[model samples]
Target: MELSAGKFLCLFALLSVVSAEIFFEDRFDDEWEKRWVKSDWKKDGDGAGDWNHTAGKWFGDENDKGIQTYPDYRFFAISAQFPEFSNKDKSLVFQFSVKHEQKLDCGGGYMKLLSGDVDQKKFGAETPYSIMFGPDICGYSTKKVHAILTRNGKNHLIKKEVPCETDQLTHLYTFIIRPDATYSILIDNVEKQSGSLYNDWDLLPPKTIKDPDAKKPEDWDEKEYIPDPDDKKPEGYDDIPKEIPDTDTKKPEDWDDEEDGEWTPPTIPNPEYKGAWKQKKIKNPNYKGKWKAPMIDNPDFSDDPDLYVFPNLKYVGIELWQVKSGTLFDNVLITDDAEYAKKVAEETWGKHKDAEKAAFDEAEKKKEEEEKANEKNDIDDIDDDDDDADDTDAEDSHEKDDDNNKIEEEATSTHDEL
Candidate 1:
């Protein structure tokens, strides 16, 4: 009962797809309100901003909608729960697409993966998370992806500078952590950073450290160069003055020696004078290399086989404070397969990225045209004001001429009468 090669390959593909488990996914469709819960942590203080369900002001597809943060200078907190799962000996992947349509000046576009059931109504910056991954933008100083992982009640941030997309366009961010403790960060399906969790985070003590007992020997000559004793100072070096009187100077014709001080020529810098003298340097014959304590195995370091595991992950959330909100989050996914996540990104962000960019460019061009039109209108207004001022000046001149003619007529009548 042997199967054909084509049939075997198809069966294999089906089995592969089945093995990749998706713990949670959200396209933020019409039923998104049912799936998501908004926090009321700042509602009473009038600091909580609302979330708008739309594709944004400029988007490729109206149907391809997501949840967006609304208004400026407010806090936003929202969460969605899924069945509990663990990534003890498996790969864990978190991915989503975000678009900072407001050209986010200072805000976070990152998402969080919660380990347990969290109070969705009070979910804010204080809520603990197992992993936080995505872009965090704040002017020119901070424009990098934040990859933070929580272990043993402590959250550890990745020690790598991973740059993110700063444009006002949709970008897919993917974070994958493997059982082997290696992690990778992808922006728009392209790998931007990858390293071991042990190296990137302070999850565990370092494997090696400098030997504590090792110290520099007392007689060790660590200096590479020494002053040359054979190099001597030139004769009459100190006698050469730093300044010399200018020989071209002549006495002034109107010099008052009694009233003013005696005339002295101004001094100029001496070209022949060397400011200071010092001995030259030469390589030391007994020079030893720079001293460093030898490295040895750290006694406190103990490797954990499950450093990358995040057990009981049951929720995904977004908690942020945006000074200018317009960050749209969509296509959130948590899975055990990298390929499946990549495929999802491709079908969503990849398919519409170019169209979105084109739409954004068109909007920017329209805005520029409007600004130029406003500038032209302002100039026209200024010119109109100047023309009115000139007209008033002409009227005033006419009034003055009439007054002068009346005075002249009065004066001529008086002279004729006299």
Candidate 2:
């Protein structure tokens, strides 16, 4: 048998495809060996639980079945390392099952692929490319699975509402990350939705820090935005017509550096005290500064002319002028005994007259606009009737033309027979 070059190449390609297996699973159910790293993700708390050898369980917080009991209402993440991914391999699949003793209120306990190694001390950095569980209280999240894939390393928020069931003993969640960087999630082996993560929500910045006014430090500005070098599309949007570069966009410079500075070592109020401040209750009486409280004007005070106080004493001088009783008092009244009332009335009358005229003018303008709107409506009604007549005539002409064409066809057939 003679083997051609084409046949040999096809065989080689087939062998390469068959040799690709990137998954590692711990199927032995061994309780002693730490195959996966476990951690209590309760923000700031220690992982607490006892492993039940007989029941093969880990218990903590509240749901303390024989196998699993956690003291804090936090999720214990277990992960295996896979440092073998290259740019060539695109699709990755993850499968897992979870059983809850009772329904939970807190939105916790979901599995994801972390880019970095995660353990008790720190949560590894991984774009939440997949979510297979839900917080029990967020209604109707039974086997709710959400799958996300990284094209340029941004998460596209997609909400998949699964049918709620609290009594289900165990639920299986599966995800298929495709070659094109799009992903699909399946709950109980049923795929509800699939989308391309290369465009749209998948490539957006984190929702919490997307706003320009958000609290972000100048030094750590790079952490806030994940720049995408490859993808820049305007899919799943109406306002945007084309892709735009987000490279030039940066955190505002005006952000306070002092406030945003990382926690620094504090200087002791008195370093001479060789111990904790509380242990040495040394009262330094020299610290005599009391915190000042701002003073507010008395609200009970009234701006009334009747409340004014007057003394029957001779004035130093007389700058003679007559003014109205309600006229505004001048500061010069202390030195001069002038009739300031007359000057105030003359000055204030013009302002009062103008205010009255302005009110009347505004009312007149509003009335005129209303009348104009009514007139316009009447004109629009007449125009609408004319438009209807024109439309009817155009329709009649079209129908007549169609009828004439049919009659001509009949006459032509009869002539041909003769």
lDDT of each: 0.92, 0.38
Task: Report the lDDT tens digits of candidate 2 across residue range 252-276.
Answer: 6765668876433333234222332
Strongest candidate by TM-score: 1
Cα-based lDDT at residue 137, candidate 1: 97
Question: Positional deviation of 344 in candidate 1, in angstroms?
Answer: 0.8
Off by over 4 Å in 1: 1-13, 244-268, 403-418
* Alpha-carbon RMSD, each predicted model: 2.9, 44.9
